[model samples]
Target chain A: MKKIAKMVCILVVSLVPTLGHGAFQAIGIIKSVEGEVYLISSSTEIQAVSNMKLISGDNIITGNDGSVGLIFKDDTVVSLGPNSQIEVQDFVFNPAEEKLSFAARLVRGTFSFITGQIAKLAPKKVKLTTPDATLGVRGTKFVVEVK
Target chain B: MNRSLRVLSFLILSSIVTVLTYSGCSKTTVVLLKDPEGKVGHLVVENEAGSVDITKENEATTIAGATSKPAAPKRYSEDKISSQFGEALNMLPTQPKHFILYFKSGSTELTDSSKAQIPDILKTIELRSSEDISVVGHTDTAGNSAYNMRLSQRRASVVRKLLIGEGVRADHIQSTSHGEANPLVKTADNVNEPKNRRVEVVVR
Candidate 1:
């Protein structure tokens, strides 16, 4: 029994550090909510995760059943409709110090996005990929729908 | 002398009459060809104010006062996907995988090391652009359920914000706060297990 307890303690101790390693910061907001869908992020760092601080490199997404919203650190707003999926592929800020590479994938459904400062500085740094095509934005308001 | 003078005058008169008749006949033929339907074609003249109409007969239609021809209709090209990328993307997981993003106790801030992992997540989504994504937020059993729910939402929102900033459309994400309802490690109340305090990302 003593040996079993000691082994169990060792296993728990080994796992603790790995568990605390990764977390996300909140950098945006949820602007509106519909029946089962929500429109989030209008501009800047209006929203962040409840317990986490949203930093420059975090990724935000919707929940199952197609619902949620996000506002980024740079007053950029994004709204997701039903049955949609997107990912934040990359991001970098501080143009004078470092450049950002922003990329996303639209798996399915519709999404509306507003441009931000980072997008304006280096438009080629940002890319939105769909199953059919990849959208290279140079500072513009656009809607992407993927089926 | 009188006969010679009369002959010369007659030749001159005939030659002049012949030339006049030939010129008149050529003019009529030219005019016939110019008037295809016997009604002049309407000339469309565009200016800054608007379009003006002028009727005239001509061999070719023309837009008067316009410097250039009308533009052709625009055509869109199809998306080109390489076969290799398509095959590789097909082998990826279809259902959303659960990834735990652990946070410090009582703090929602993501550390520098934690931020590094975001690129991998983004790359996975980019590689599998055909799949939908779902991110669920959860917390340890230390806090109140209501508070935890709100906290989980905050965590989800953080991910949502980061993804959008990275160019993900706002509509592609849905955030829900499980509020410690689904614990990964499942310890007693206020145990402070790092695994339980996390946000799970599942790509569908």
Candidate 2:
């Protein structure tokens, strides 16, 4: 039993250093996944589970019955409805240094967003871009379905 | 303040005149939000329809006809449009914000690479409105439990000092040490794992 735990810990350690080496950090974790949710990073797709760390450049997709919720470092909450696709373009939350930003591209489907500390502190820095238009936040919450 | 009120009343009076004169077509819908303290945000309506500006909180204007100007601003309530904004949280990623500063064997000082990650951690603190922080220190299993506990406490203290020096409110931070009890790498007793001897800082 001890050997198994040790090996598992070793494997996890070896796998972490190879991920997300740039300034793009893991901005949030998967709080819950209802149905089919996949995280596509680089070129490989991995099944997403609760507590899975997500980073920039990762594309999140949900199946017809799928939905995902995430609680970000800035205490911002996000829920992606089914049949949705989203790409995290960039995310930066450095409260001590006062550098906070959030930008994402929602290709299609439905999503509900609650503005985070970044938006509360600096509303102009947050942008949500879709194919037809770009959405900015003045209010704290918005839900949109892109046709 | 009086001048602004006068301008607003004048605009309302003129809009009333325009609506009465041009009340020949579609009905005008005025969506008003109730914010006596006026703490709402502005919304710029620029879809396929003509552009309209809702500058003040909880107020909106809709013209009666296609080419007519918008009617006077009206107040809207929070419950009226609550459903319009979905409740699904759209959160940014949070994983990268968690930072771990590794230590050399038998030393509480940060390793070279860990030293480099400090600036980013400080920057993270600067971005938040308030600090909600946790610092947990650990040591490799190379030493006895008692000694490791003290060592880990020292390490946590070092980080706490740095954070306080860099502007993190001292009271907002909680620090603890788990010497050789929990290991990131799960090394055997008397083994030295750089990853195991570390301090983890979580900021929420």
Best by lDDT: 2
Query: What ranges in model 1 sit over 4 Å off?
Result: A1-147, B1-95
For A41-104, candidate 1 gives per-residue lDDT tens digits of 3234333232223343433443444444444434344555555556665544433233456677
Candidate DockQ scores, in order:
0.02, 0.07
Query: Lowest lDDT 10-mer window, candidate 1 chain A?
Result: A12-21
Worst lDDT run of 10 residues, candidate 1 chain B, spans B27-36
TM-score of each: 0.33, 0.46
Task: Show model 2 residue runs off by greater than 4 Å.
Answer: A1-24, A95-98, B1-204
**Which tens-of-lDDT digit does each residue in B1-204 have in candidate 1?**
699999999999998887565433321000001121243322232323243333332211122112223122122122211121222122212222345577777667655666777887788777756223556677888878888888878987898788789877676665666677667665778778777777666442
